[model samples]
Target: MDSLTQTIYECLFGAEYYEVNPASDDNTKAADVLRALFSANEGGEHLKKSVHDIVGERGWTENLAKAILGGIENALKQGAQMGKTMADASEKAIAEAVGFARDHPYFCALIAVGVLAILMPWVLEALGFAELGPVEGSFAAWWQSTYRGYVTKDSLFAFFQRLGMVWH
Candidate 1:
């Protein structure tokens, strides 16, 4: 199975990926030692036995030296896998975010508004947009105009009525 599928399977099913350590050169195998250190009341005896099995499988006399070398090789391979996994995961996450934005435009607009509010000052100064407003007919006066041009004052009452502010 692919490494990502194997990892997900282990996470979801609590299944052992190996009865003993696989002879794979993945540095993450050494991470068991770190996990043993941080996990309270935990022992890495299983991992030690696995390493010993690895050494014996190779007919190595010195367990510690073999384990160290194997760990370095394991770490190197795992590091490459980790980098690829991160890049792939980031792409998927971005695609998911785009999907979410498509499904919920109002929520996305609110988020955009909040971000704009926070960055408005820097953006205004950088783009020199602060000097423009609809008061004298700048883009800032966007609320007063449409793509077809400015709305006439005759529609003011109609606009208020559309907003549920009708006066009898």
Candidate 2:
């Protein structure tokens, strides 16, 4: 049976591919360590054992395994560091987007009121079948209609009517 570490490592990085050249001092084994870190199934003990098995299977003497373990450790360590960087970048992007929206108050207000206008039908229904007039030319009504038209091909009036609250 394969060692648990080997199993976990394979689960993580088995999909990675690298070309090896027999004549050169290629460090492709780092690929295995990285894959192990990225795998969802890995655990600490399993990873340590897997590294031992991998180096052992590669026919590295004890001295060589000790030497190569340093490089392997560095590779997996860097992969984790890179993952942190990517997550930080994503968080920063969302923060910037929110800041931009806040800085553009008029655009944000327009969106908020438009959403409110969209919900007006439900508001009226809750107020007990109030006789709301036709939205043929009023500014709020016209804006909603034009906006809905541009977005959904349904006239704003028609969209509100489908909510069973707003009239034409």
Candidate 3:
């Protein structure tokens, strides 16, 4: 009976099912309350199995079943709304990440280049380089040791200036 109540609650509220007030030991009243909750939205088929399990003891009529079905429809609508809200939040987060990356092309390229450099040692070792600790050390020691020296305003601008000169 307790299990039946829990199933009914979960079917109605989804995530917040456990947070709501549920009926205690009274199977009859629990069935009635669940019926009313379902009646608002057409939830009959959603909880049919749980209701069927207790029908004999709870004495559910056809009218009660119809009302429960109605409640299920309402619950479905609420679930859809929750899903939309989560989707909106995810879209906003992705948009912000894209905007930040767009505004910092040099930083983005540096991150990509750093990742590639870090992977190059493993790649080189796979291709039969025996003593390439210098390459590994270069990447590992970059940010922690001399990142500020290499990425200073004048230094970075100078590097870009050299690149422009080469390309031009």
How many residue pairs of model 3 clash at the backbone?
14
Candidate that would win on TM-score: 3
Candidate 1 error regions (>4 Å): 1-82, 121-168
Task: Give the best candidate by lDDT.
Answer: 3
What are the candidates' C-alpha RMSDs? Answer: 18.9, 15.8, 16.9
Quantify all predictions' global Cα lDDT against the true fold: 0.42, 0.46, 0.47
Query: lDDT by residue for model 2 over 19-119, one digit each (tens)?
Result: 12211222335444444444425355776777566545665554334334544444444444434433455458779979988899766655664575566
Candidate with the larger TM-score of 2 and 3? 3
- Candidate 1 is scored at a TM of 0.26
Task: For candidate 1, list the clashing residue pairs, or say none.
Answer: 25-74, 26-74, 26-75, 27-74, 27-75, 134-141
> In model 1, what is the error at residue 52, expressed in angstroms?
20
lDDT of 2 at 15: 21
For candidate 3, report its TM-score: 0.27
- After best superposition, candidate 1 residue 147: deviation in angstroms? 22
Error of 1 at 150 (Å): 25
Model 2 misplaced stretches (Cα beyond 4 Å): 1-82, 117-120, 123-168
